[model samples]
Target: MIETIVFDVGETLTRDDCYWNLWADWLGIPRHTLSALVGAVVAQGLDNAEALRLVRPGIDLAAEYHAREAAGRGECLDESDLYDDVHPGLSALQQLGVRVVIAGNQTGRVGELLRGLDLPADVIVTSAEWGVAKPQPEFFHRVLEVAQAAPDETLYVGDHPANDIFPAKAAGLRAAHIRRGPWGHLWADAPEVVAAADWRIDSLTQLVDVVRA
Candidate 1:
């Protein structure tokens, strides 16, 4: 049985459409360009620093993208408007007596978002604070330590296969891939990603069954 459920922040708990479109508009770049650039960065296996460098030349990189949702323009982005589905799912999980945590590559902004949303989490493990990003063994290990959960006792739900599923499995956690439309294609041709995950789900609601089973 799963005692703890850890979630990825971006696509898993929140809909990021507004954020991306805002960035694309602010940079005067086509939305597709931004999307393609992100795809390229992921495909190239660029680290966060390298990814930031590549985008900085053309866009504000972080600030402009985050300012739209965050309360203070220059300050960190707040996620007060979490996706409609996420809050209910979380509440359900809590009602079921499962501990919940968030494990993602948030750059300190997610914490602010959580506070803004009034969503209190048991623990938060972010790459910025941990000094390591997902798909890295150390990242998952750090989260596991904070959650006080063995890999087998915890369930990691995330959208990115490489960043979420791959590393979680490597660190001994049960991994689930939350395939959200076009983004799912990233893993379609990669057998390793599919093999890494113990389950594949298209929606957060599906997690209830996965956990119950």
Candidate 2:
């Protein structure tokens, strides 16, 4: 039985719609153009960051992020940023006495943002806080420690097949691919990636049923 359900942050628990627009504006590119560029990057099976570099040379992502953060322009997930299914699903898990955690590759400020938002997760962890990120064995191990959960008893849910499902399975946890975000829809038709996940869900509501079942 799954005792702990760990979730990815961006595009999983959160919508992440604000990011593309923000980055596009910063790159001086039209939002739709940037969207197509991102789609092309995924189509070519290239890393998103590397593709961004190819699209706009000399773009320092970290520097840009820091500049925005310092200027009080950093993005935060508001109540409206969550998917319609997120709250109900999380709340259902809470009521079931299941341990819910938000563990994903995110900046240090992510924990603070989630805390402020008061999401339903019992334990919230970010890549920055753990000094490691997903697709890394160490990161999942850390999550296991915090959750006091065995690998087989944990379910890792995220939108990215490469960074989420594959790694979680490799770490001996059951993995669910949520097919609504960028990575999800991008890799939706990829048989190998789809096969790697133990479950494929289109909505967060499906997860409540998964755990309960």
Give residue 27's lDDT in candidate 2 (0 to 100): 71
Query: What local lDDT does model 2 show for residue 102?
Result: 90
Please write out the lDDT profile of model 1 over residues 1-213, one tens digit for every residue: 888889887778766655555556655678777767766776665533343356566646556546654644333344543666677788778777788898788766665556566664677657887888777788888878877777798999887776788778888889888876334556644777777888887777777887688
Candidate 2, backbone clash total: 0
Q: Which stretches of candidate 2 lie over 4 Å from their true place?
A: none
- Local distance difference test, each candidate: 0.71, 0.84
Best-fitting candidate, measured by lDDT?
2
Model 1 misplaced stretches (Cα beyond 4 Å):
39-81
Ten-residue segment with the worst summed lDDT in candidate 1?
72-81
lDDT for model 1:
0.71
TM-score of each: 0.78, 0.94
lDDT of 2 by residue, 1-213 (tens): 889899898889887667777777767778888778777887776766765686688988899889988877776767888888888899888888889999988888867888788788899889999999878899988988877789988999998888888888998999999887768898876898778888899987887788878
